[model samples]
Target: MGIVTSLLPFSIRCEPDGDVLCAHLAKGNRQIDELREQPPTSVLFHGPQGYVSPSWYATKREHGRVVPTWNFVVVQVWGTPTIRDDVQWLREQIEELTNAAEKGFRMPWKVADAPEDFIQAQMKGIVGLEIPVSRIEGKRKLSQNQPDRNQAGVIAGLRETGQEALADAVAEGRRQPDDFSLAK
Candidate 1:
């Protein structure tokens, strides 16, 4: 949740562990300084999304009355972020993070692939974050607000734009019950 912004393009990587979220950030990052003063943080995870033009709606052609919208899926995690500067913890965090990200690749890379001294030096530059989860909220704004035919039109438009993933998301949303009251 720590928003690391610097002159250089260094990004903080957040990892999830059970009920807590972790982030690997630079030692002297502005975000770290801000967190020291105020610990609360919120991390947002955004899934596939694309702009939906009125032209993508079947109703627009039938009645000439429709508006633009966007389709997206997002999750927000809220908690207090704690910074830990332990070398072992950072090493493990980096290892797990690397493994998870590389698992689907043809050739996965490991921290051990690099020299120990070099890796040790790299680890020293960052700190680990542990944010105990207080609340987690999620939302999916697909074409659920539209009629079935309009939803299909949106899916077709998304696919035409080479956004198969977004089209798939809309299709998935369409499969859900209209009333999500059962969801906790």
Candidate 2:
């Protein structure tokens, strides 16, 4: 079968064992159907990302050589999937997911807050997936190609626009050495 791309809003979690990733799919979704065939799969995860304007670069004012770009962090994982329909495993996965998502709430909701029968019934409509990671690649593009002043400008621009996460990433990127010849 050919590759079928899907942009699923999955509640993904990396297992403590560090070897696998877990998520779920609605039973009838095409992606779930394809995974049942035991084909190789790839999952992409996006971290902080944002648009960058040339106006934020010091070089743009000193010289007209800068162009708008995007700053982002991403990870891609490849593996063969194991489809699971076991109720117990599904329950555990969902509970962990729920706890993580609701951690910031003053009153966090839980799976047990709902009736057991209703939770069980809802589980029937979804299947769990475990992908034993075979390979992982990551990239962080946080204005590493620019000079120090320009990078500082980007950090300020991102923060002023309410992109604190991306701004932090840019600041962190400044500490990491890169191979870009233009970096200073």
**lDDT tens readout by residue for model 1, 26-82:** 786767767665466777777798899889888997999898987888766677777
Candidate 2 lDDT score at position 126: 92
List the lowest-lDDT window of 10 residues for candidate 1: 6-15
Cα lDDT of model 2 by residue, 1-184, tens digit: 4777766544555556557777777887778777888897888888899999999888888988988999998878788899999999899889978888899999999999999999999999999998887777778899988899999999999999999999999999878653222111
The numbered model that scores best in lDDT is 2
lDDT accuracy of residue 58 in candidate 2: 87
> Relative to the true structure, how large is the alpha-carbon lDDT of every model?
0.77, 0.84
Top of the candidates by TM-score: 2
